[model samples]
Target: MAETDREIKDSLVRAGRPDRVEGRHVNMPVELGSTMVFDTLAAFEAARAERYRSGTLYYNRYGNAASFKLETALATLEGASAVTLTSSGVAAITLTLMALTAPGTHLLVADNVYGNTRAFCDGVLAGQNVEVEYFDPMIGGRISALFRPNTAAIMFEAPGSGTFEVCDAPAIAEACRAHGVTSVFDGTWATPVFCRPLSLGVDVLVYSASKYISGHSDCMLGVVACSDADLAMRIRKHVMAVGDKTGGQEVMLVLRGLRTLDVRMKAIDAAGRRIADWFAGQPQVKRLLHPAFESCPGHEFWKRDYSGAAGLFGVIFHPCADDDVRAFVDALRHFGIGVSWGGYESLVLPVRPVRTAQRWDEPGPLIRFNIGLEDTQSLIDDLDAALPLMNTGLEA
Candidate 1:
């Protein structure tokens, strides 16, 4: 007799349980609480002592069982000694930077990293008297030359924002080790499924769980995973102090997303490469910026280090009027205009990429693309119709 769909799903779910849970299944019940109650004064004192020594939670502000399980799962994926959950990705970045760097320390950042990350370093960290230095996204091992004695940490985002230049993460990690600086990678692009930052010698790994981890664009959460005992303690303490905690439902949603992560990512990865290859052949597209493609910056590094690529990539079109370019995007029937990537639905955003550090300017206007779970033929048709429209003569 054949098994029912529900029974098959249950069995499939059992097969993908996180190893660190010690025989526990992927479905963990949420534990909601404001304040935990103790029956005896001795027990209360014991709890207080535990809270002081280990930063254990007596209230939801610190954490609950749902959040704790999420942290444990993330830590297991990152190969870190521990992980701390935050309300959002920026919260993780803010709290981690606040805990790791002193007011007078220096920070080096990738030029094409997420705009808000650069904003945080400049507006928040630099405002506190910390020196902020921007480096080319393709700096790789050459990053060592810019390190100063007061440099506290280095941040990286692989296949960086807009242009999708894959950095030499291992080389950067080595440079960080030589300078005795903490290395943090925004692993939201690859997540733990494709890249393990700790395995490559990065000190800390951060994620914006709102993207792929939740898979539905519903919840916003962040996770910081690290192997250093001291750094883990610092992040936990900082998160608790600021009350940057995710709720039980969000925690459960992320957990549910994790169960099908392998399946979802496999589809996205395969479909993305197909669509990217098709875009490369279009005459209107001057260049395709995808780490998996040979023409991409740091392609060799991505081939060597990363096991797989995500659904996001960038494209440069032949010089055209703004309206023409907008019409090209508007012509697409499948892809939607959106701010964030990493959802089940495809998206496209036009960008005017400029050179800040070096001469890596685009021949034409730039646009970022996120390939979704749509059929490859449908996405190809949408792009085919859109690319020709971009080359039309414009009335000034």
Candidate 2:
């Protein structure tokens, strides 16, 4: 179709388009649009049916070319039939749970999921009269024993949030399939570069792209990957109804991140192992909660399923006064003190595990470290310097 006189005059200016070009852009152009104008009534009707879920040019709320391109990249990564982009990481998880469940729905969630996830289950899901049960993250094939007749979905996120306990996801996924239950997984800690949850038989894979995928901590994004077309469509419709949308700029940020995901993950994996090993050898460190280390719970399963480990890990310092532990963290020079991780700068966070299925009986201070694109030796030096501060009061 030829450009209309209006397009030739002001449409290019309205689009913020570059000078008229005959060649293609190396990057996916960020086409900002909301109101889509169809040339004719026939074209409009055809679009409402044929192009609705296909991510073609339609209304912006459903999805646009920019968001769909990013979704396609993620779907390709995780071996999923479809991917839905969301506003934030938590939104992706919450939306999936809401879409697949209802009042009286029996939902099984891993006890070690992110605190935000647990809050949603405890507050929103429970308020709606949904039956929410928390199971051990390492329950594995035994998870089937907890499933009820009305069990609608089971959610799991591994390299467990604050505790760093990896889940035997394949076993749980297999059980979900046998019982005809939806399995939702969050592998944000280990993006598709290190792990692909869908191929492990999980029904839906939810991930936060804000961390490792964005690589620079500038974008807030989330994704849901589903291989079953019907299941994908159901979730997509729910997302549309709720008016959840991923902005074109945010999707573009993720697209930029993907160009280097594999190489970046490789570097992060090496640096993480180095730091975890250093922590393991420290006399003040009682336990290393790293997936690649044998001391970490579910390390065997991680080795079996994952191609690499995320740079994030947990450490428990041997009995030290709470003040001394705070002093130790305060004395760190290279690592930033923050809650979120998986960016270019290293971060250290004091974290405590909250569990109901299992008791956290360890008598020590727990801290999480996210080793970023930093010099391993410098990180080790910083850790080494901070270790003595933890023992300042104990040694006396």
Candidate 3:
């Protein structure tokens, strides 16, 4: 019988138990090794042949038992045919692009994607002679107009990293399918808990497990889940060629984080929504860029497809000096100023939207908030105390 996602997640925690030492271990043991031994030359040769044919573990760089356990759990969660775990999120993106695009291939990317991704496209991919184009995040079905015969892939990110502009992922995915263009979605914002891109017709789903999957600020990991077996194999081959394998200890940490992901996501979501509602009433705020809110771009698409929202969103402050913006962020006591979200600690960061193919003309300074597992009232109080800083030299 088919189990629910929650059930699958829970079952995975104890699914692949190690062989009984006394009785049975509740979790898969971390098998750290660089080489595998066989009883005879015949067995060793057979294993080598099998590894070449199936791409199984012949070396640690290929992946260990612990990494495979986490990969299995993530693949099942995403409802993907296969998964490739990489050293980091950017590595996953790099590997996926390397596997799919060759020289002279055109790749269409959402304009509001993570800044580093755009840098990768501009720097590395362009250096290799790949044509990169950035389109509006809200383009939806119109994305097809930008495709050419040589267009190899479309990179998408719903509720784009800093601006919180949601994209019509399903519409875009359908358009890509019609044109035979591969679709790669950055699912880090929603993870698999709130949104499943594979079900929405995305060919590849990439995630920065460094954030929500780790659920802590420690380990760095990334995962690429593919609905197409051919693409999955290609990505795996690229990863192997690049020697991009996550550490066993880091994989175990991510596995531990997955165990509590459901509850943590719900708690963080509730806190974020509550804070966003509060921000809506603040006079200094020009607009709230949250997908669950009406003012966010492509909100209708979010409402139509997503089951829930995540803890990250943006706040566009009413026209204020850059100094005031700095003061507001610096005054916050509870929220740390840093990049990356989905951890247990609240964070705030000043963001300046950067676009080449499109214009981001918000009338005021933008600040992104990452709600964390702190007391709601304390967080609200912190914001209330800091918001006055936005008006700080103006009243004089």
Candidate 4:
């Protein structure tokens, strides 16, 4: 009998299940150890020889059973031939770029990528003699104009970080394919539940598992998924060589979090869209930077390429005094001020969009919000109470 396709939630729940276990434990046991003992010398030699070739598990640094289980689950989720777990999301990005690029390699990066990503490219990759050119996220199919004969790759983010400008990923990826250049995408925002970059012709898909995959704010982890087996091998080899490995317990947390990712993502999406729509109706909001809205740049591409939205979005306040902006955010009781999001608690952060290849002309401050599992009406009431702070110009 042919197996039928299951829904994402069902697949996630069933993923990484051991075929047979003695104790019948629902989750994979956390195997924590740096060394693996072998009975015979020949077995040790064979494992060492196959380390880079077959991804043999010889040492914990290379990865343990728990890490492999999580990697397998993530690979399945992202529709990738293989996946590599890393210490952090930034490490995933760095490792993928380092594996694919060489000195003098030319990279075309989206201008609106995460600030840390830009810093790494400009500071580290630049020192390595890698040439990086930032391009407008809305360039779409026209990005071919920026490609050079020596262009090695293109890095992009859908519904870009902070600003929420959706890029034309498929069109840009098609151009990269035609030119024989590698395509890398930051899939942290949408995750595989909402968008699959591999299906869109992207060769490498990177994620900050610490945000959505871990669900809780406790763990810090990242995973890089590759569609090509050879590319995956290269990434794995590089990760092993660089000693960039994730702990066994962190992998277990991410694996556990995967089971509930679908439900959490959907719930947060509904709440975020409701708040964004409500914000649009407010006169104090200059603009709503959400991919689902037509006002956002390249939103049509988002609607066409993405199956769903995440909880993160940005809002531009009407031109006002800095004190008013500060008062509004300071007055919020439900939304905690924080740097990262995707946890159980809602968070809000003030952001200054920094762009060189593009222009940001908003006259007011911008705030990025991460709607959590809180009740929708309760969050709305919190915002309602805070909004008066801006209207009254009160520091209270």
Best model number under lDDT = 4
lDDT (Cα, tens digit) per residue for candidate 4, span 1-396: 001225566768878765576866688776789898889999999888877643477877887777877887887778888898899999999888888888988998999998888998999998999998999988888988988888998888877899999888889989888888998999899877788888888889998999988889889998889889998899889988999888878888888898899889989999999999988987788789998888888888888888778999999887777787789899999999988788989999989988989888887788999999999999999998888667533222
- Pick out the ten consecutive residues of candidate 2 with the lowest summed lDDT: 8-17
Steric clash pairs (candidate 3)? none
Local distance difference test values of all predictions, in order: 0.79, 0.84, 0.85, 0.85
User: Candidate 3's error at 326, in angstroms?
Assistant: 1.4
How do these models rank on TM-score, best leading? 4, 3, 2, 1
TM-score of 4: 0.95
Worst 10-residue lDDT window for candidate 4 reads 1-10
- 3 or 4, which is superior by lDDT? 4
Best by TM-score: 4
Candidate 3 local lDDT, 1-396, one digit each (tens): 114666655654553345458975556655677887778988878766655223366668777667777777777778888888999999888889888899999999998989889999999999999999999888889999999999999898988988988888989999999999999999999877788889889999998999987899898999999988888888888888888778877877888887777788889889999999999988888889998999898899889878788999999887888888888889899999898888999999999998887888877888899999999999999999889889723332
Q: Each model's TM-score?
A: 0.90, 0.92, 0.94, 0.95
Model 3 residue 298 CA deviation (Å) reads: 1.4
Candidate 3 vs candidate 4, TM-score winner: 4
Clashes found in each candidate (C-alpha, N, C closer than 3 A)? 0, 0, 0, 0
Model 1: per-residue Cα lDDT at residue 208: 89
Provide the lDDT at 72 for model 3: 73
